[model samples]
Target: MPAVTVPDLTVLPRVSAPGVAAASRPVVSITSAPSGTEGEGFPVKRAFAGVDLSVLDPFIHLDEMGEVDYAPGEPKGTPWHPHRGFETVTYIIDGIFDHQDSYGGGGSITDGDTQWMTAGSGLLHIEAPPEHLVVSGGLFHGFQLWVNLPRVDKMKAPSYQDLRSRDVALATSADGGTLLRVIAGDVAGLQGPGSTHTPMAMLHATLAPGAELDLPWRPDFNALVYVMAGDGFVGPQQAPISAGHLAVLGAGDALRISAAQRQQQRYATGLEVLVLGGQPIREPIAWAGPFVMNTRDEVVQAFEDFQAGRLGQPLPHAEVGDPVG
Candidate 1:
């Protein structure tokens, strides 16, 4: 219950690839999540928009958590979209999620729920949720991290933070088989109540089978580890990995995970890992889908301020079209 004593993953300093680049240290990249191919029904693989790592420099993107099996009615989710700059946590973990936006913010998250949002200067969201009372089961798993908006706060406006599941902050691992859930920053000692504008950190582990955990890296940020369904041993080069894979570690100082006693329950004890990165803002991004401004005229002035409506505001329980697995 009291653990945040972090600081040990040290190894940093040693750049010289293209020659020098290390503001505070955080360079670790990894991208791997392929399967959903044959027709895309995703019998097993499903990365709607997952796998996309970006080392430190202020944590650009991390999306490495997937699952969506809503077919009882059709229409899945993500509708009234439009963001500006960055910030969109959205961790769900099992099923259900309603979400509304434009600044009014809405609700419904169910399964362990977590909906961070912080679009900055523009908004226009929607997540929808209904149908799929569990027939095909394993509805809309989760993971939707996409941060990057520190260049002067990118716009400073849009915001939200509906973290539930008992206000977060849990940390167990003696033989109870790992738990740790400080979903924002800080680490073991625990301190994740959502209130990040950048300078990030997030941990949401779970072991169970043969369990054995260490995790505590912040040699200035930029970290990685996304396995999610089983196979163990990470960091300290125990390597190994499994379920979809993604370790990516280097400028280290702390990290030591375990679980293989024949992998305990034969792997798959829950294992929904994701320990994002931060400390990187080499600016000049200016993306174009779901907005990510920097230029291109601020994405054409954010679609002309949502077509002159001035970025509509008034969310929270404003259900219109629901269905999110």
Candidate 2:
């Protein structure tokens, strides 16, 4: 949960409170993420499970990687895989992950670090725990989100961005009861470091017990809130939400979340949540396995290209694991 922190939240820039005319978004739906296994058997929570694609336009998939503390030699990660027509955004809240791609893009990211890889056109990549981390064993927690690219940018040259925790825009609520780490897009005039292909905003927030956060949001971008730890209420209706839960919000200019007065000892710090939203693409989606495209033919072509070795090959120096799909 130590993605980013400050000695005193009051010293950070404060997010202005919404005006009286601002409309508060209502909770449209709340769903609990189902636990599952991914990559080389690492446990994950399918955060977008059971949610309609139309409601999640521009966002294809989301996996909440383990909050588990692993013993020596128990850590695991994804094998080399091919992707096309989308981007993968991996955020590490704790522990370390090493990433390498075929197009000469690779790096090791740790606590609060982020790796943004655009798989436009297609490329091969792998993600695994660093050797030291795997040998020593430790706590590993994070999230991987798949963002869909519009048809125009689907075949654009691939790119990578390594965003460190120190580069994130830090902000606090007016009362200084909540801390926000903006990773992408604009929040109350504060711009995040990560640049996105689509218009979107992503942030991680920690609210003190019993504190309330009324956040201003873009009326055009769809809104979603996922609780990473502790319990809280979302939207203006005060719907109860807890860890592993995702809340989809309706149209509005603002969002309201309130943390419970008491929390379990494990989460005494506050309620941890990831808030994200993007302008809906509103186009037909054709997704399968690791590729996301706008038509069935495009998805088929992606698979064919990957199988024919057109995507790219693994680095000669790296160990190859089982294929993702």
Candidate 3:
């Protein structure tokens, strides 16, 4: 079940969509996911959208939370904070992430669940490991992505899309080639549940030994792929990419990815990949802790609004924590 081979789904495009993608293979430019100082008690690897790597447009930032094991009684998790002018998407793969917001929204996402929260205007939120997990100890591995909001929608109302594991649809590649867990946008022939603020696709794929997938993407959109587990190859030349590396794809109509085959003497395993993309917002970016806006003054106003309790009052019973990641 490593490589999910199935009939080719490339032919099935959105009906009557204009500007059909022309057939061309894209190339991969591999880079490592950037690491950063552990913020608060949370240990995470930053993937970009910081001052160091300011290339991912429309997408502000990305973080990969521990692929490490937590010994019993060990402490870890993001604290509480306020956000405005953007959205945060949290995908929990290995543990539970309890969430509470100043907007009166609260929930816990366990394995394979995702929380897509829009912090438009403003909102205070916390993402910490469940107390039970802290007591028992276990693996805490997941991803959190920050996406920029269009200027027109920057002040839109905040909202959330809490998708359980089962809500994310899977698409198999040609002849069972690859298995894709679609979180947003279109994958193969299936659409994800997330009602996106911008056009985008957030897909997770697993490749066995020889599985492969080709995404017919819009040329105007910017795309990137991050390797999460094992090794894989991208494009026609099969450029090798090890785990924790991200490939910023070159221009073309299709993005190809395949699991690397093992040598006769080497052991084989599955490769896990996370693919992300969206139409470039192409707007001026003014960023601060938890706030992203077009102008510095707007960002300052966000902080002012928070201080004035415009975001909403925190729950008296809620735990105190920071949202720094």
The per-prediction CA RMSD against the true structure, in angstroms, equals: 16.2, 2.2, 4.6
* Residue-level lDDT tens digits of model 2 in 162-261: 9999999999997789999999999888799999999999999999999999989999999999999998899888999999999999999999998999
Question: Which rank order by TM-score, best down to worst?
Answer: 2, 3, 1
* RMSD (Cα, Å) of model 3: 4.6
Off by over 4 Å in 1: 1-85, 89-118, 132-140, 156-221, 226-231, 237-261, 266-272, 282-311, 316-325
lDDT of 3 by residue, 1-325 (tens): 1222334535323222123445544554566776654444667776762233344777878888877688988747655677889999999888778888877776998777889899898887877777888899988788888889999999998888888887777666664656677889875457888889888889888777776766777677777888878777886577888777877776666677888676222325467888888888888888887788999999889878877778867533323223364
- Please report the candidate that would top lDDT against the real structure: 2
Residue 314 of candidate 3: its Cα lDDT?
52
Which candidate number would show the highest TM-score if scored against the true structure?
2
Off by over 4 Å in 3: 1-22, 37-39, 49-55, 263-268, 314-325
| Worst 10 contiguous positions by lDDT, candidate 2 | 316-325
Q: What is the Å distance of residue 236 in model 3 from its true position? A: 3.0
Candidate 3 lDDT at 228 equals 78
